[model samples]
Structure formats: C-alpha cells, structure tokens
Target: MNWSWLGPPMDVRPLFPVERGAFLDLLNTLTAEDWERATVCPGWAVRDIAGHVLHDQVRRLSADRDGHPGPAFEPGEALPGYLARTNEDFVRTARQLSPRLLVGLLDRLGQELDAMWAGRDLHAPAGLDVSWADPGAPAPTWLDVAREYTEYWVHQQQIRDAVGRPGADGPRLLRPVIDAFLRALPHTLRDAAAAPGTAVTVTVPGPAGGRWTAVRGAERWGLAPAVPDGGRAAAEVELAADTLWRLASRGIEPAVARTRARLRGDEALTGAVLDIVSIIR
Candidate 1:
C-alpha cells in the first residue's frame, strides 16, 4: 500500500497573524474579575492560561527565531513532567506582571512571530518534533506551526470558557485545530494489533468536522485523510468536533468522552481512538 498520504502537510501560513490578532482581541476584552476566573485546566485560572500562552509565544520566538535553546531537562526527566514543571514555574512567576503589560508583550511578540513565520519554508524540517504525532522523525515546518496555532487557540478557548464569552468556534479557527490533533491517531493506535490493511476510521461530524482512517501497515499504523475502499473499516467512531478536540487534549476524560462517542465494529480499535491525547500532558 502507498503510505505517502499519511500525515499530509497542512500549510496554515496565513493563520498565524490572523489567530494572533483574534487572541489579542480576546485578551483585551477580559475584565480583571474575568482574569481570576477558573478554567477547565485544573487549578489554572484565566490569568494562568494567559500567562501560559505568553510563555508559548516567547519560547517559540526564542527557540526558532533567535536560535536560543530551551532549558535543559533534569536528569531522568520525562517530557510531560519536565514540561509541566516549566509551565507551572512560568505561570507562577508571571503573576507579578499586570494584565496590561501581558497584553502589550503579547501584541508585540505576536507580530514578531508572524513575521518570522512568513519567511520560513513550510517543507523544511521543523525546529522541534511534534512528538505526540510522529515521535520517530522531525515534522515539517507547517505541522509545527499548525500545532502552535492550536496552542494559542485552545488557550483562548479556555479563557473564553472561563469568562463566559464564547467566540472563535468558527470553522476557520477550529477546523485546523481538529485536523492537527487527529495527526496523533497513528501513534495513539500503535499498540493495537491488526492485520495488514486493516483500517480504523474516526469521524467528527459538524461544520468543522472531517474523517480520517488509520490503516495497519506491516510494522505500524499510518493515518490518511479520507476513508479507503468504499469507506469500510474494521472499526469506526463518530463524535462531535467539540468532544474530539477535548478528548484528544485531555480536556475531557476518556470515560466521559466515551459517553459522547458512537462506536461500531471492533471495540479495541475504537477504544484506542478514544484514548488519544495529542498534547504532551
């Protein structure tokens, strides 16, 4: 079978500046009270989410634009633990800054990121691997940037959810987030045993929804955009776009999300899809 279709490059080049502008607009509208409200991220308030996004922006510019390396991991530090510690450290320290300063820095740094992204070749090797999606190799620049876009968007959504101001669920913003998260399917299903050519399909239904199928190869599973061979599969799952994103990001627990998922065919393959967590934590 031709495996080239797996994990196709998504050139979300124009989305960087647009997403940044929306993020800034969202942040500017928050009241001081809104900043203190709790979000879905456990023990993290709206202010912490804002601070986290700012850290993300700074880290990207430092690592990719300025060629500065990130902090070294402690000996025997796993990726998730190290990332969580660093993120919490940043958020804890960032509390000293006023909201106005945070917005101003984000506005300026976002412009820098937009400019840096505009000049890069999408097909070039990424500065960091999107380890959740494809740990075996460095991703293309497009996928890396798309993941960044999702980070900003997801944080913005958290803030919105906290403040009771819900916007930015449009297909343009959310569709890409869902698409990028689905890239984790192959890795999510890596341990599920299936014969060569066995297909597991996942479908998210809505304006921002799409279908992806992961086919068992000789040594691994490979994900492709569309279903294969008359849309048949050994397993298939249908879920809403909101559930899929939250499910893949650990924003919602597997048992809770499974309540929303409609499963058919093989139970094991469908269960594997439900267990997907696209982020490091």
Candidate 2:
C-alpha cells in the first residue's frame, strides 16, 4: 500500500485539467432524472452538486484569479458554520439555474481555474491555510492546490455514486486525493496524548491506496510516508481506498467507517484515525 513512486509534497496542479475535463464529460452524459437523484451529500441532488461545483469555480476564479475578496464572517460566526451557511446558500439559490447553464459555466470557469493554478508558485505561501491540515498556519501553494483537487474529485464521486455513472476513480486521480487528505492526519491527532516516538500507521490496501504514518514528535504529531527507522507503529488501521476517501470526506459516518475498517493496537489512536476529516464540516 505504500506509494514509494509518488513521494511527499504532492503536486496536484498537473491534475486540474484532466479532472475538470472528466467532470464536464460526466455532466454532459447525465439524464434529466439523473440530475434529480440524491447524492451522498445530505439533501443535495446531482444538480445541486453540479451547481455547488460551479459555485466553487466561480468563487475561486473571483478570489484567486481576480484578487477579489470573499464575504467576511458574520458576528460570532465560526469558520465551519460560515462555510456551511455560504455553501448551502449558494446551492439553494443555484437550484434555479438550468442544468445546461450550470455545465456551461463550469466549462468556462474550469478553464480559468486551470490557468490560475498553472501560474501559481507551489512553494509560496497559499492565499489561505488548509485548516484541517495545518490549522491557523499558512499552507504552501502546493497543498492548497492539492486540497482543491480532492474537493473536486470527491464531489464528482458523489455525483457518480448518485447516478451510477462512475469514472475518474483510477489511481492517477485517486492517489493524489488520498495523499492530500492524509495531510490532515497530524492535525486530527493533535490533541491525543502520546509519548514521543509513538507512531500510527494507516494503510489502504488497493491499487489507489497507500500507507501513511503519523509519528508523535516532541511537541506534535507529524505525518510522513514512512515510519522512522527502528520505530514500530503503536497503532495500525487498515481499510479500502474507497472507504478511506469517503471517510475522510465525510461521505460516510465514522460509525459506518469503523465497521468497514480493521483495527490493531491502541484504541484511542485508531479511533482518532477513523475520525480524521479533510473537509471543514
């Protein structure tokens, strides 16, 4: 399950065009009924998901490409709540747009997004932090872009699941998504009280999966591709790549993930691994 071929600091900028092309192709093949089908995103249908994707592109283009700032948080609002409210608000209003219009916008804006990403310096500080990965700290441009790829890929999978028209699940597409999501493992176990040198290894056993170990350091847990030399993992968790993606993205509940996952070693560490979520919610 270890991805020795693809090393750390995943550069997902190369993936944007391919994933976006696949997204548009998938949208064009949907039937009228398919647009109305329910997706794993609670209460959001296929069209809603499409509209959500459109909204994401528009917001990114405006903010990143055009340097336009987005709306500020309301009084007393939290990050997760603000994001949830704004996303739901957009999807609700977007329900009025025809499917054709949604796809058309995605086509145009997707190109802009791809271009924007192409011009970014991967080593520079990102516009915003990937909160789940390194909360309150500036993320590198590469990690930010990788997070964007995972978002688009996960939402596309949601649509495919609803309509039973799967595509873009190959190792090329999914491996980066899994790797990007695994960046959040350190933050996920941030509060866990573990002695230095303790390590937890998570393995997704499939073509698209790989191994990641989060080792406890003097002050924090750090995620890496391999465990340190002579260090044995204090806990290990194993699951399919499909389950890992869904679990990381909140497509499935942790209770459900626990049933599907195999656990060994410390219960608290394994439980923290199961609770790892890549999204704001």
Candidate 3:
C-alpha cells in the first residue's frame, strides 16, 4: 500500500489502521541495502529492528489470544532488563532470515495485529499487565491500545531515521505517542512525593505537540491538561518535539535531551522527567 508519510501527523485516536498502514508502506520501501543500514539502536541494523517490531506484535497478539500471561520471567527483574533481554532473544532468533523473508514476516504480523485488535474492546480492562505502568498491575484498556500504536510509530521512525525518510512529525502522530509515553511518568514519580498540589508540566514544542501538567496529589502524581487552569507547576520542562519523543522512547540520551531542553522550576522533578523512559531499556 503506497501511502504518503507527508502532511500533518494524523489525529488517530485509539490509533490503528492509519499508522499501521503508514508503517507497512515505509517497510515496503526499504531496499535490500537499506535494510542492512545501521539504525540508532546499537547492534541492531534496520532489518533487525523490523524483526523486533514484528516479534513484539506477534507475541502480544498471541498473548491476547491465549488470554493469560506467557511463561514468567524471574521475579523482581527490572522492566528495562526484561525488555532488553526479551527483545535480544527474539532478534537473535530472526537474525538468520533473509531481509526479504523478514520483511514478509513484518507484513504478515502487521495484518495479524490489526485483525486481533479489531475484535477487542478499547475500554475494558486489557488482558495483559504493563510492567512499566505500576509494575505488574493491569493498565487500562485504552492505555494498552495507545501503547500499541506508539510502538509501531516509534519503530517505524527508527527505520525512517536510519534511511533518511521524514514526515512523522506534528501532533497528529506524535501527540498520542507522547501522551502514552507520559503515562509512565506518574508511575515513575509515584514515590517521589511533592506537596499536595505541586505540579510538573512537560511541554513539547511544535504544532503536533502539547503541554501536560502532572500534579502531585495526596498520594501520587497524575496528568492533567497543560493549561494551568488548576494551579502553577513547581517545575516545567520544555523540549522540542523530536527531542522529547526520542528521550521518552529511549531513542536519545537523557543528558543530551536535557542539554537541549529548557528546564525551569524544581530540579528534582526535571531530573525525573529526564529519566522517564517508556521503553524497557
């Protein structure tokens, strides 16, 4: 399917189909040589990343169908460690395949994921637990759906970055990914108590961007609309759209993003924002 990666990012709520199509279109354009090119992910070439994406989709789909957790990892394992090891194992298994075969798998698995999501409800409790969200607790169904789209978009962006393709910028595509990524922020700050009403506002600067304030409530921090109609933030972090997405996804270095970012207010809160990562490791 030939689709334009250009124009504004789409307003794809409960995002699917559109971004999935876009990812597939971009995947189709990768030349054999392009697939061999190195992406920002260390030790993973463009083709390996594609394999990783496909592997994740297939695994998640299978888990959903089984309606139970897959074989358990050791308890008390950190989220990033679990993801990195799991992803590495999957990528290693797919490493011997020809780029053509791997690409074909991406297409097939994408269709499977799309079909699996179609029959599912977006508002009910999702079947899986998002470890990043409350450490083994079940996240809301909408959050799970949002994370799925963000996964596809970010992986596709990695390929685009490797091959010098552009056009996933702006709010339509990024806003959802950014919002979904930020869901972990409250969890990240769950223990870092602030005064009852203190807040932290994360601002991504661009047309497809927004400001979200996470105010510390009695027991935890939670996200609210950016406009401080509620109260002033104790800390505000402003980063360009690209930088924030990259950092949140662990696609960029925290130090680097912080250097390029405009930080105001509380230092500790800003530090937590910098350390916020949606990806495992």
Model 3: per-residue Cα lDDT over 92-208, one tens digit each: 988888877776777777777777777766556675665555556555566677777888899889999999998665577777887677777777677675887777888877786
Best prediction by TM-score: 1
lDDT of each: 0.85, 0.86, 0.74
Candidate 2: give the clashing pairs: none
Counting only residues 3 or more apart in sequence or on different chains, how many pairs clash (N, Cα, C under 3 Å) in candidate 2? Answer: 0
Residue 165 lDDT (model 1): 87
Error at 133, model 1, angstroms: 1.0
lDDT of 2 by residue, 1-281 (tens): 22221136678887888998899999999899999999887899999999888889988988888889888899999998988888889999999998888889888888888888889888778857788887777788888899889999999999999999878999999999988888888889998889988889999888888788988888778876577786678999998889999999988889999999999999999999999999987
* lDDT winner between candidates 1 and 3: 1
Kindly report which residue stretches of model 1 are placed more than 4 angstroms away from their true locations once superposed.
1-5
What is model 1's C-alpha RMSD?
2.0
Candidate 2 similarity to native, TM-score: 0.94
Error of 1 at 9 (Å): 1.2
Q: Each model's TM-score, in the order given?
A: 0.94, 0.94, 0.85
RMSDs, each prediction?
A: 2.0, 3.4, 6.3
TM match of model 3 to true structure: 0.85
The prediction achieving the highest lDDT against the true structure is 2
